[model samples]
Target: MRILLDSFVSFFRNNYMQLAAALAYYGMFALLPFLLLTALLLGKSITSSQEALEGLHRLTYQMVPEFQAVIFNELISLSRLSDTWGWVGIVSCLSCIFPLVVTIRNVFLTVFSAQRKRPVMIEILRDFSTTIFLIVLLIFLVISQIIYDELIIRFFMAISFPLYIVDFMVNLTISTVGMTVFYYAFIPVKVGLKHICVGAVLTSVLWAVINPTLVFLLKLNPKFGIAFGSLKTVFLIFMWVYFSFCVIVFGAEFIAQWDRRKEWGILSTKHGKNGVKETSPPLERDPPSLTP
Candidate 1:
C-alpha cells in the first residue's frame, strides 16, 4: 500500500500530470476535425449516411448528456454541409489529425519509454494508422450497439433474463477491450501484459465512474448551456475530452510508476519471479531511481 501511494506521488512529482493537461488541450483541438472526417468516412461505409451521423450523435450524447441537443444540432449542420466539403477539404481536415496523433505518440513514448526513440517516419506511420484505428473502433462500437439492441436483446428475453444487465456487461467488456487496444498499440514500447491489462481495466472503470458523475454535476448548472447556447456542445466536448485525456494519462503514468517501483525492489511479490516485465534502459545520466 505504501509503495502504491509512493508510485502515485512519483507520478505527480515527475510532472506527468502537467503533460496530461497539455494532451487535453491538444486533444480538444483535434477532436472537432477528426470527428468530422471520421463521420464522413463512416457515412460512406453505411447504407445510409444519416444513420452514421446519428450513431456519432448518440455515442457523444451518451457520454455527455448535457450536450445532447448541442451535438445533435451540430451534427445535423455538419451532415448538411458534408456535401459542400470537397475532397480537398476532407483531405485538409485529415491532415490536421496528424499533429494530434503525433502528439499522442510522443506522450505515450514519454510515459512508457523505450530503449531509444524509433525512426520519425515509422512513428508517423504508426500514429497515422492509430487515427484510422480509432475511427474503425468507433464504427465497430456503434455497430455492436446496434447488434445488441436488435438481436442480442431477443435472446435474453426468451430466457426470461433482464437484458439490461447483459447490455451493461457487454458494454463494459467492450470498453475494456478498446482501452486495452489503445494502451497496447499506442505506447510504442514494451510493457508487461499484466501492467497493460490492469491499466486498461482501471481506465475503463475510472471513465465509467467519472463521466456519469461529471454529466450529473454539469447538468446542475443548466445556465451553462443557455449561456453558451449553440456553443454549449463545443464547450462540453472539450471538457469531456480533457477529462478523459487526464484519466488515460494518469493510468499510463501509474503503470509506468509501478514498473519503476518494481525494478527498484520496492513492491516485491512473494513468488520467486513475478509476472511483470522489467527493462534496464541505459540512461545517459543517472537512472530514474527513486530515493529512499
Candidate 2:
C-alpha cells in the first residue's frame, strides 16, 4: 500500500505524462501515412485491388467505429488517386514513423533512468533496431487484420454476439503482446521479464479500454463533435495516442522504482512512519572519545 502511494508520487514528480504527450503528438503524424502504405502494399499483392482497399476500410472502422465516415472518405480518396503519390506516401510515412519509433525508444530509456548506461552509438543502434521491429510488427498487425481476425470474427457473427466483442478480444491480445515485446526489446537497460510483464499488463488494459470508452463518451455527449467540428475524429485519435503512451510510461516507471521504494521507507510498516505501524529505530553507538 505504501509502495503504491509512493510510486504514484514519483510517477508525477518525473513528468512521464508530458513525454507521452510528445510521443502521441508525433505518433499521430505517422499513423495516417502508415495506414495508407499498408493499403498500397496489400493492394498490389492481392488478386483484387478493390478487396485490399475494402480490407483497410474494415480494419479502420473496427478499430475506431465512431469515425467510420471519416475513415471511409479518406480511404476512398486514397484509392481513387494515382499510384505516383501512393509510392511517395510510403516513403514519407516511413520517415515520420522512424522518428516516432525513436521517440518510443526514448520513452522506455527515460523510464529506467537509473539503469546502467550504454554507449551513444550502441543506444542509437538499439533505437534503429527497435524501430525496424516496430515497423515489422505493424505490417504483421495490418496483414493479420485483413487475413485472420476479420475473417474468423465474421464467420462467427452468425452465431450471435455484437461485433465489438470480437473486435475487442482480437485487438486486446495483439496489443498486449506487442506492448510486452516492445518494452522487453526497446528498453536498453537490463531488466527482468517479470518487470516487463508488469508494464505490459498495465498498458494492455488501458489500450484495450480506450477505444470502447471513446465510443461510449461520444455517444453520451454528441456535443464532442460540435466542439471539435470537422476535426472531431482527428482530435479523438490524438487523445487516444496520448493516453496510450501515458499508460506505457507509467508501467515502465513502476518497474524501475519498485525495488527502491524501501529506501523511502514506503515499502513496509517496519519503518514506523506516520503511525501506519510502530517499530523501533536502528540501534545507535554511544560516544567513547569524549570521556577519554
Candidate 3:
C-alpha cells in the first residue's frame, strides 16, 4: 500500500500528466504517417496492400472503436497521397514518426529517472533504431493477428469454444507482451524482466479496460460527442491518446517505485526515503579524535 501510494504521488509530482499530454499531441501528428509507413512496408511482404489496410483497420477498431472509422479514413487518404509522392512521401512519412518516438523515449527516461549521457549522434541513431524496431514490431503483430484470426480463431469456433473468451485472452496476452517489450525498449534504465512484466501486466489490464469503458459510455450516451460539434471525433481521439499515455506513464512509475523497494530498509522508512546510510562509521575507530 505504501509503495502504491508513493507511486501515485510520484506520478503527479513528476508532472506525468503534462508529459502524457505532450505525447498525445505528438501522436496525433504522427498517426497518419506511421500508418502509411506500415502499409508501405507490408506491401513488400506476402500481404496485399488491401489486406494490410484491413488488418490495420481491425487493430485500430479493437484499440479505439469509437474513433476507428475516422482513423481508417485518414489512412485511406494517406495511401492515395502516397501514390503521387513516391519515395519522397515514404521518406516524409518515416521522418514524421521520429518526433513521437523521441518523445516516448524521453518520457520513459523521465519516468525512470534515467540520465542522458550518450552523444547526440548516438542518441539520434538510437532513436532511429527504436523507430524502425517499433514499426517492424507493429507490422509483425498485425501480420500475426491476421494469421491468428484466419487459423486459430477458425479452429476455436469449429470446436464450439466461446469466441469472446478466446479473443479476450489472446488480446490480453498480446497486449501484455507488447507492453513488456515497449517498456523494456524505451526505458533508459536497465530494468529486470520481472519488474517490467509486472508493470506491463498492470498497463495491459488497465488498457484493456479503456476500450470497453469508452464503448459503454458512448453507447449509454450516444449524443455525448454532440457538445463538441464538428470536432467531436478529434476531441475523443485526443482524449483516448491522452488516457493511454497516462496509463503508460503510471506503469513506468510503478516499475521505478518497485525497484526502490529492493533497497535495504526502504520499506521501513516512514517518508519513503532511502533508509540505508551512504557510509557507515568504522566499528573500531581510533581515539585520535579526543587527542585532536
Candidate 4:
C-alpha cells in the first residue's frame, strides 16, 4: 500500500508526463533518420526490395498499429533513396538518433538515479552505447515477432484458437518481456528483476488495451482527426507516441518506488529494532496472542 501510494506521489511530483511529451517530440523528429538508417541497413542485407518493404510493413504495423499506413508509406519512399545516400548523408542520419537516445538516458537517470552528473565526454559515450543497445534490441524484437508470426502462430492456428486473440496474447507477452529487460538494462540503478517485472507487466497490459481502444475509437468516428485538417495523421501519431512515453515513464516511476520501499527498510524481512523479524514466516508456527 505504501509503495503504491509513493509511486503515485512521485509520479506526479516528477512531472513525468511533461518529460514524456518532450521525449515524444524528439522521438517524432528522430523517426525519419532512424527509418533511413534502418532502410540503409535493410538495403544491404535484403536483396529483394519487395521483401524488405513487406518486412518493414509487418514490423511497423506490429510496433505502432495506429497510423501505420502513413509510416509504412514513408518508409517505402525513404528506402528507395537509401542506396543513393553517401557517407555524409549516412552520418547525418546516424547523428539524428543520438538526441533521442540521450533524452531517454536522461529520463531514466532522473527516475532511477540520485548521483551527480558525469563529464560531457562520458555522457556522450554512454549515450552512444545506449543508442546502439536500443537499436540492437529493436532489431531483436522485430526478429522475434517475425518468428512468432511465421512459426508459432502457424502451430497455434492448428489448435483452432482465434488468430486475433493469439496475436494479442503473444504481443502482450513479448512487450512485457521486452519492457522488463529494457528497464533492467537501461536504468542507472541496480535493481532486482522482481522489482521491475510488476511495472513492466502493468505497462504492457495498459499499452495492449489502449492500442485496440484507439483503433476502435478511430473506426467508430471516422472524423475523429477531422479537426486536424491535413495534418491529422501527424497529430494522431504524435499523440499516440506521447501517450506511449507517458506509460513508459509511469512504469519507471513504479519500479523506482518499489526499489525505494526496500531502501527505506519498509520491505525488509530482517530483524527489526526489537530483534523480531519484520516479515511473518511462511507458515504460522504460533497462535495469535490474545493480549494486544
By lDDT, the best candidate is 3
Which predicted model would earn the best TM-score? 3
Once fitted onto the true fold, the runs of candidate 4 whose alpha carbons sit more than 4 angstroms away are 43-55, 266-292
Q: lDDT for every model?
A: 0.67, 0.64, 0.76, 0.73
Clashes of 1: 0
**Following a full C-alpha superposition, what root-mean-square deviation does model 4 have from the true structure?**
9.3
lDDT by residue (tens digit), candidate 2, 175-256: 6677788777767666668767766776677666766787788789877756878887788778766776777777676666
Question: How does model 4 score by TM-score?
Answer: 0.84
Worst 10 residues of 4 by lDDT: 283-292
Q: Candidates ranked by TM-score, best first? A: 3, 4, 1, 2
Give residue 175's error in model 3 in angstroms: 1.0
Error of 4 at 107 (Å): 1.6
| Cand. 2 Cα-lDDT | 0.64
Q: Which digits, one per residue and each the tens of the lDDT, describe model 1 over residues 7-97? A: 4665566666566666767776666676667667766443255456555665665555566576556656665677678989877776777
In candidate 1, which residue pairs get closer than 3 Å at backbone N, Cα or C atoms, i.e. clash?
none
TM-score of 3: 0.85
Query: Cα miss at 142, model 4 (Å)?
Result: 1.3
Off by over 4 Å in 3: 44-51, 80-82, 264-292
**Model 4: number of backbone collisions:** 0
Better of 1 and 3 by TM-score: 3
